[model samples]
Target: MHAVLPVAKPIRELHDLRPSDLGPGILASTEPVVLRGLVAAWPMVAAACASADAADAYLRRFYRDATVNAMLGPPEIDGRFFYNENLDGFNFAPVRVRLDKVLDELGRYRGVEHQPAIYVGSTTIDTCLPGFHDENRIDLGGRDALGSIWIGNRTRIAAHYDLPDNLACVVAGRRRFTLFPPQQVSNLYIGPLDLTPAGQAISLVDFLQPDLERFPRFALAMEHALAVDLAPGDALFIPSMWWHHIQALEDFNVLVNYWWRQSPDYMDTPMNALMHALMSVRDLPPEQRKAWQALFRHYVFEADEDTFAHIPPAARRALAPMDGDSVRSIRAQLLKRMNR
Candidate 1:
């Protein structure tokens, strides 16, 4: 039997929102907010509301025989995509298949008691469904957002954090989002950073049946959990680095999401620095590690004009304000050293 989890606090909701209401302030918010009926008027949502078959047909109209990457798992996995028992690999196998064929397979499994989990995740909307965005779209206030679509049947994604801010719109079926603040990282029992089911490291705790005995810290994380259910036409804004576990609640589900990073494109991902720190600092002797920590605090974490006040401006080549050129130079220098 699965252990019952504590009820999560409901997410804040904004009613009567329009596409234009997604301004800079909302996009920059650190908290998650639900925009009810934001995409409810979309034609795709109308088709989905009419029937699953109608929704499939509407999606087929835009699919130009494109092959998409899909994750397939047996009934035994119970639609939860995760690592196998050994944690060496994933429970589901990834396959490239026709988008229409996936829709057909989903249609075939309709109403079945125990259906296989079929998920087509993170497919670029413009690449696969060329003109779909023309009819159905959201304005992100000129932010260069990458639009992606997720099609699946009754699946649960492990709790994970993304570097980019997200605006997720539900076009078909219903989805439940369980969210935790970025500060809850220590309590989440995150899996191996280098080895992950998806691109990002995910929480090891299973939401459906949490093994609290093994992951006792998860109980503390649950205390800070906030959740919300989103139906067709509803949208949710998730800020960068907030951990979220998503479940496609119905048999047929389609979600369109846009991701945009607040930082410049030239800036390297912080994950690189984290990996480097693990190699260079984590295993250091205790006293040296403490000394390095103080150095990092002075130079990186709590850096300001005073940090380089002793040095001449011309001599502080790296310490001065950084730009595209300086970033490239630093990256090249790091690469040269690491390759040694």
Candidate 2:
């Protein structure tokens, strides 16, 4: 009753996970870990086993019927949500619909032969469904972190990476997550950043039926992938920047996940630096690029230990030690430089 009868392996397993285990220093482990039956005791998971109607009713209790941004794709896309073949556009279109309406739409397609893919991805609980976070939430030290809901029917979210540490729990139905290590980013064949479906770059190659001839490096990426199937109440911990391709297996499925960052609030997102680097350094000649690599290693890659040890703290205003005020001052200076 806790999880599906059994599933495939290669994923590391942890049991009876607590919020403390996920507190500070959690990311020291670079691999994905499955918290077996972490949320099996939740009441919503019990409702899921009773019937589809039961599950729908249980979730609707916390709903305030607020309209949310949802995605709709034709069956012709074969449940694989991604960009068009030419990579110029997205295959599916997004629309705004009420949460109650989505549940009613699920009720209508109970026994239909073929159903349209209707997905509500990353809808923040507080904004759209209201009060849903009260009863259903993880105990991570994310008091300010938002709880997001993903609901769909046999839909696939193309391989993508999120910038925050994620704790995803299954509330209803089964889901399979095929995960790749962050080190394999180069081999995933990432698409255009500006044309992403959900503001996240997705892999261009279709993993189910990969075109190895076109994407020969994907085979190497597959060698490092770890797959796990999650049933009702099961949860998976996905570290930041880990590429994962998620599949909602059943005709109706629901998932709630938490995304939080362990970094200090003063530190800015690395995405901005990545974009700036692409413009400033990605295409330089081999020798100059190698010289820049040394600079990046000293300033970015190395730890900040003893960085200004040779100088006295009184002599250093910006580089001595950092606080909220100094970080904001540094950010203002960067803005001035960019504006120039």
Candidate 3:
């Protein structure tokens, strides 16, 4: 029945996250790591605020009356509202509102077959500038992908993972984020249609009051879970495959996030995937299952040089080469096959 979760390191400043500052071997592994100052510099924080301020002000005013839009629409099944999914172009929205006027207009709009609103606004860094700092706009090309804004009241985004590593900057008001690593997917109490729960409307479990009796595994999942309260000018980085649940704390909570793939052209490792297929999908008779599992453990996860020498130098060279473009092309080709 706890409203918030605990974090081992409670960070208030950004400089604390520098990899060099944290010491060696911190980010060297693929495990989830939290960096405090990765984007704590004044330039980055101010830029994020500038990117989201206008839209934040608008949502605070319009969505303040929780009763008005509480159940107005069905849940959004597509998991792109909170996380940016690059369908084609950047999914950024520019929403504007006059606070005072919205407060007066809330009650009259009830009793209508309220159209579920999934607001997607458009903005160019130059045109939507709100003076967050001296020189505000960020170059999306330099950073691999652009930044975006999300604003709402008591709004909730479902559990899902993104291919890219993410940086979320909260400019105005406070918000809570509940995160789970990918390995805990089995115990997450996932929702309907293989789509996100509530058509992706609500998080699978009520974040504030998780029912341990019904979902006992969630307690163990919490051992690896982390929660962060991103305030104005504070940002958080979420690595790939880290499941996260977000909730707006105030009437208008605004967030702008920057997303960059770990490697733009890198593809999933086929050797690992094929191994998984052999165990899970390729069907082994009962007796062979144990043997296959043991063989896989020894040759794959725990494999040494003896098992891998079968991979010729040419194929190994194709995986990651000194030439950047060659590696990128191989990565792209691999992605195409996976999608097919």
Candidate 4:
């Protein structure tokens, strides 16, 4: 599948970077970076390097028989969890099963040529594996990053953008990442925002077999694509809003990722604004829409001191820099207006 596309440039690599090295400067980088052997010393990575069985055994130590949500698909799906032919439902079924049970299933189908796809995604590290962080962890300087684990086998996840900057560490098996800048959003051929296999929307174009005739603009996206393959213990820093397609290259893979947003937690997600604009502004008369566009540019996109300088500090309620109080007030006002 990877061989079909034009050769993509490898992402820039840095080596021997400790957790302390991941400071504000590195986190602020717009481009994706590969940190080779960032977690090579981790016990989990060492277990993975030994063999799949060893890795599974190591993870089982922390499993408290907690049930986790997993996406299951037949061998026919070929590890690509996606929508059905009608696009009304998913090809995979979501089920709740014990963490140890998932591990047992992965072990059963370890080396099978055609095995049912099982993916346990975004399960919080602290919840499922209580003491996992005690032995293995990264210090994101004081940032309250959320740690999540993804366990899967020979699966391909479609391109999707995340709101928070991500540091994904490959703890077991091998994986490959295909990244695109935020600007390539249009070329990626996005799916329905309201309905998605995951919480966020994903690219409709299948990288495994992209139909150029059906998705001509995806060609442009390919031209700007960046690719990298990560071994166990390797980590990739993906900037916020960058589109990424991930493939679990090895038969059994486990990835632990840290996600943190640079913005204040009080602020709402920009997706809400997009949906609201679709309802309130998109169908307006062209002239009126254009007028709103200019206003948005002035107040949102191109906003700066100059945009609000005319208003006194006391009068600039919403225009002032946002805080928890102001955001709550604004949200309450919006709710009031919306209910009316």
Candidate 5:
């Protein structure tokens, strides 16, 4: 069961969640997790720079000097506007400057200096860059090679899932992210691959303003949506396939992130296929729609205790003792269906 909570600032504190706390079969909160003091020892923090100052400097550099490539996509139409679904291609360039130099310049406003930007790639960055865990620290942990940064002004990225799970760290300014569960593609009104309009670049959420009349279903989406404000040193982990909308809060806001897919293939398709099937088969069939609607109420909405009561001991044993193979197989199926 879900409770309606007033929207508030993102969580700034960090706490570990045991597997027990998460329970089984339930997903993590779709809301952003704020981890405070997570990056207290970061090189920038050691310089005693204000979050905004560090962010501004970092973002200015990223936007001004980073090399960027245009993302390609097919276009499509929704309600009225056409949308382009191109993803930006960028190259990550390693920085040769000292951290002290970068931090020092973070405080000053250098006017209109246009240095040729470097395109930074994701692979060069440290995987542990986003982790606050002691075991994942640099030297003892791993080094961050993330050399490039992305600076999109009014620009937007299309709706596509990332292979790597992303931990976005905001350094220079604030960004607003509109996210949807991977399962909500139908409700999202995704653009077509054949053709797309210009304004529908990265978001299905009407940015100009919500047209409640045309997109009434969006009201229901609001219930499922969560927004997070990212400040300096604050990082947000967007688990793979979770739809997201990212926007710069200021003209010079900058952010850096580390992305890597978990091993053995980080994808699922069967679940996606099942969802597609259900939407078409069950929802389209008026009679079955009502029946499955009740089923969803019992299992998802009401959480009826009787639903799993008949599980045999053998079945429970297998289900309870889940392993990597089971996870892989499930995810693989979901990924397969999604690609289709």
Candidate 6:
């Protein structure tokens, strides 16, 4: 019976995944890859290899006393972190506690029959564990990338997409990631964007107990999805806009990831363009909307190679490629138009 359920095709894996393979261009690619044993020698993973207790002890050494943001939800939810039924807010309540206290709390639940779901999500490594970066830093040719840590006890983050490319390494325990291509966004039954449980929008369909009756379209999304189970020291590269749902299989788990924009820092997220279009263009009459779609396809979505090859450089001021200064000026002009 289990074999009959739809599961994503096995994602490709590469042995001996290394920093060289994760150069800016490669890491920024739209293709996703699972790098087996990529961080096998990472100190945290090494500790876990010795024993789960040893891993806990190793992490205890780096817990700063800083109050970190965490979430608590009823065990009935069964570790799925998501929004409330009304979709107005989250089912979990947010809390702030010392990182060490959370670690200790996880220790107390070793043999408990039932425990409330708790998670520390997307906390900056520097704020939660001050010096963790010194040993775990990835040299990206000096690009200013950001690092964040997720610590939790058997929790699941609903399927959601991040704006930038990411490299996530499992440090302790085990994790499973279910991924969907960006094109399947519509089939995922994404919740409201403006009113989201976390910062990003999440899929309304629950993977563990998918309400097929209500979300029949989700079955379509699952057909194209790929799932992978990652042990300590394994890492995954997630391309921008690829939706992923993460599950922490063990009682206690820790994951660290670095996120960086593929484009230059001067450019803003295309999400802004999407949101603006949502407000300004979505409701236009059919013919007007079709006209706008053609404009967007030619000017934005298409490749840059031959789009402007026929236009003379001097006459194609706005159509030409732009630098930081040019972008700023264009942004200023857009702002003026918006104000009007």
Q: By descending lDDT, how would the candidates be arranged?
A: 1, 4, 6, 2, 3, 5
| Backbone clashes, each candidate | 1, 0, 4, 0, 36, 1
Q: Per-residue lDDT tens digits of candidate 2, residues 76-143?
A: 88788888778887788889888899888877876676888889999887887666666655667544
Better of 1 and 3 by TM-score: 1
lDDT of 5 by residue, 100-169 (tens): 2333332332322332222122322222122222222322013222322443222334344553456665
Worst 10 residues of 6 by lDDT: 1-10
List TM-score per model, in order: 0.97, 0.91, 0.56, 0.98, 0.48, 0.92
**Model 5, runs deviating above 4 Å:** 1-32, 44-67, 70-148, 154-160, 193-203, 266-340
How far in Å is the alpha carbon of 113 misplaced in model 4? 0.5
Q: Which digits, one per residue and each the tens of the lDDT, describe model 3 over residues 1-340? A: 4433334233223445431243223322344444444434445344435544453344443233222111122234221343234322222332345333333333223222332223222222222334432333433334454455554444556565665666666655567777777888766776432333223322355555677677666666677777777666555667666788776655445566666664544445344575557647568687877787788787657766665577886776643333666767766886797779
- For each candidate in turn, give its C-alpha RMSD to the true structure in angstroms: 1.2, 4.6, 9.3, 1.5, 10.3, 2.4
Best model number under lDDT: 1
Residue 241 alpha-carbon offset, candidate 5, angstroms: 2.0
- Sequence-dependent TM-score of model 3: 0.56
| lDDT agreement of model 3 with the native | 0.50
- Model 2, residue 72: what's the lDDT? 84
Q: In candidate 6, what are the lDDT values of residues 1-340, reduced to their tens digit?
A: 1223487787778788655456655576687888888888777788888887798898777776778898989888888888887887888898988888888888888557677898998898887778877766565566567899888888999999998888888988899999999999989998887887678989998788788778878888989999899998888989999999999998889898988886887888887888999999999999999999999999989848598889888777778887898789899999999999
**Total residue pair clashes for candidate 4:** 0
Local error of candidate 1 at residue 6 (angstroms):
3.0
Candidate 1 structure quality by residue, lDDT tens digits, 1-340: 3466678899999999887678877899999999999998889999999999999999999989899999999999999999999988999999999999999999999889899999999999999999998989788989999999999999999999999999999999999999999999999999989888768999999888889889887888998999999999999999999999999998999999999999998999999999999999999999999999999999899999999999999899989988899999999999999999
lDDT of 1: 0.93
Q: Each candidate: what lDDT?
A: 0.93, 0.81, 0.50, 0.92, 0.44, 0.84
